[model samples]
Target: MSARTLLVDVHTHLYLPRYASLLRSRASVPMIRSRADGDRLIILDNEPSGGRPVGSQYWDRDQKLAFMDKHGIDISIVSTANPWLDFLSVSEATSMANSLNQDLEEYCSSGPSFSPTLQRLYGMGLLPLVPSISVPTILDEVDHVAQLPHLRGVIMGTRGIGKGLDDDALEPVWSKISDKGLVIFLHPHYGVSSSDVWGEKDNGHVLPLALGFPFETTVATTRMILAGVFDRHPSLKILLAHSGGALPILSSRLASCITHDPVVASRLQHDARWYLGKLYYDAVAYGAEELGFVSSTIGRAGKYGTPTTEAVAGSSHMTFGTDHPFFPPILDAVKQDSKWMSVVENLKAIDGVRDWSEAEKSAVRGQNALKLFGLN
Candidate 1:
């Protein structure tokens, strides 16, 4: 609500043309099928007919700037959207990761001639994490990413090295990533297996995309907690997608389950709830109630009022996001200049939380991401 508050959208995406070209050539689940209307992205096997309509918005920088301008967004921290390089040959993945990252760096630093709206962009890079690659190769990429002038961090999927994030193989990778002081933007791609319930039902992609993605994120992060990735690399920072899925809602129950267990409880330095606070969340939960819950639970859930807790509380841990190009405009815009409904909903969520002051809201909008990524 503050006039001075800079709106920072952390949850927006742009697939580099190089990456899209790879997808176009591929013959797999995450491939893109050309169409008369526009290219359709089929991330899941079930969405065989075609996934969402893929157009210039997914890869074009001009469209990205246009969306930001229309939305009144002050700044954006862009990333490669879901289904990121997960299904490539090890050599192919590694090579492509480096090229895409360099391309992104060029895109982000594409000159400072423009004014605030079109020019306000930063990037999160990627890793070639398909399991067969050596940890050294992954670490090499981490070191490589650190050198990109405009890149803040790397985005990773839940299936770390294809063995899930909890795989012991990821430890060294985690350490190196943390060593660079880079954020690991933990976005979800693999939702719950559809075989259990969704396969039999014709619920469209709603069940898998809406529910399954978040749930997968919840499970993956929880597994990391149990594996003590946080305790090992306490400096490592992970920003979760979709407001941490159900992790914020069920954190205490998870802690209780972990604590009650005679084996797991005895091994941890802190409870399950403590680790949740260590993570950051994007404000893409879609409603004020959900945003308020996420802010209170994760921001103040564990060990509230400490010097450390105070640092992470309020809007400091939550960043705003538009998820543009994915959720296009639907319904008539209330105002001729109004942005997409998906973007407006997120803004409304932040504005609806009356308990937070202008300063708090401002932090969630941009200040947090700036400090977290050292963008300021």
Candidate 2:
């Protein structure tokens, strides 16, 4: 990796101090508990053990910069980790959303200077999308996020206004986001329940995190497309985590199914696959082959359109990411100053992808994100 080639991590997370404090004060499943060794974070309801260890890497700015320096990441667009504002009541969520957004602004804007030429940090703000929250309130939060200098977008879960993303109630929210020119980082929290697959064995979170999470994203986005979200808000910018979570592989099948169903066959303005080109994907698939395949799928979406012929390069629509603080190097895998396997694999995947020129690879590494987030 050349120093001249910028690397931007769009999928990084930070459990800001305020958020961690809020979690510690909670008494329920998503709370944080302090133990002998360290604090433990339990965000998922079905976490196998108690939860993963919480550390300064989650909230410490210097630690984040050090990790970035170790991995050669030039900039990162941090987002609040999963289960954001999910458990809070409407009033609490709204208030905290405001506070967290400000905290995020401070976290990004107050960072130490890394390079004279580089602005190292930016963020994706949160919204109060909990149930019973009025659209006006959410819209106001959107405006607030837009006004924040260091906030480039907003992170959201599969659920939109209590229902799934396809809910009609989210129409106003989507409109406001699009109108504000804010990218929606669509992430997943509550993955699909699969007792049938996992059975009773201590399979842990392997199934839920890997398969269930992406499957949830696939379902939620598919519903949004089927409900004519893209048709309604053509300018909406969404960045999908985990390379759209099996969406590229399953798009053709979904299109076929949509065509076969009379009720939905004539609803969409274009083929189901066309929307892939309009969206952005993070290169966190962990394999060059998987990244290449999804890139080709997204690249081909333009040609699949019914009446539009906008050809898109798949690589141009993808961005680099490291899901830091979530997947750190194991003790056995650690070498002195060694990069995490997770980050290395993703970087290697982008570098090893077939048919991508140096310029295209640079775009995937950081140029795309720079443009997507309007970063300097």
By lDDT, who's the top model here?
2
Model 2, 263-350: lDDT tens digits are 9999998999999999999999999999999999988998877664779999989999999989787665456666798799998999
Give the per-residue Cα lDDT of candidate 2 at 361.
Answer: 87
lDDT of prediction 2 = 0.90
Question: What's the true lDDT of residue 118 in model 1?
Answer: 38
User: What TM-score would every model get versus the actual structure?
Assistant: 0.93, 0.96
Off by over 4 Å in 1: 1-4, 111-119, 304-311, 331-338
List per-prediction Cα lDDT, in the order shown: 0.83, 0.90
How does model 1 fare in lDDT? 0.83
